[model samples]
Target: MDIDLTAARVVLLGRPGCHLCDLARDVVQQVVAETGDSFAEAVVDEDPVLLERYAEQIPVTFVDGRQHDYWRVDPVRLRRALAR
Candidate 1:
């Protein structure tokens, strides 16, 4: 499905083979599913800029293009973000 640009974004940034990243993705997916919000995934290892910026902070989540969460996803905060 195509995402609406105006909608809030749930960005999951992580690398392969990271268990924590996988868990973070799952939490993000759950939040998006509950809120029916737009979602995007960024592979830090593939993007030079993201790699440098989030090299040590994989599993980061961004809401509306702003850094929202890192290391873990907060479902309550995510839902509230979507509501706004």
Candidate 2:
């Protein structure tokens, strides 16, 4: 899901032992570096409810409290999302 940076509030749902989640974390950090926008990271396993809710969809990305991407990070879309 593409997001508008002017109003974007991103959250990365991640957990340990997840390669894709690690990659997503890197991508989000890079996006922050290039765009200077803030984002949040939520470790699903840290919260059992979150873990159960997002276990199959680790590394989920949300923009403005809405689901954007999952499983993998899409840099192109992310850049567009962060470009205001």
Candidate 3:
């Protein structure tokens, strides 16, 4: 399925085999579930632009199409952002 990341309320940028990405996914999933928000995951390695812009920031999280956090996701902060 083709997911429009821009339209998603939350976007997760990361590559496979990333431990941090795994953790971030879990937190994002939990927060979005509670907030009734939706999210999309984009593998940085799959897109050159995403890789270039966020290669060093795997596990990056974007809320409302704006960069929100990286390396780690704080559920409280994410919930707060979604509430905005």
How much is the lDDT of residue 12 in candidate 3? 95
Clashing pairs in 1: none
Candidate 1: tens digits of C-alpha lDDT, residues 1-84: 132222347777778888888998888888888888888776777767677777787788888877888887878887887789
Clashes of 1: 0
TM-score, one value per model: 0.83, 0.77, 0.90
Estimate the TM-score for candidate 2: 0.77
Give the local distance difference test score of model 1: 0.76
Backbone clashes in candidate 2 total 0
User: Global lDDT for candidate 3?
Assistant: 0.87
Worst 10 residues of 2 by lDDT: 1-10
Candidate with better lDDT, 2 vs 3: 3
Q: Regarding TM-score, does 1 or 2 come out ahead?
A: 1
**Residue-wise C-alpha lDDT for candidate 2, range 1-84, written one tens digit per residue:** 232322446789887789999999899888877877778887776777667767898888887677779999888898787674
Question: Over all chains combined, what TM-score does candidate 1 have?
Answer: 0.83
Tell me the spans in candidate 3 whose CA falls farther than 4 Å from its real position.
Answer: 1-4
**Which pairs of residues collide in model 2?**
none
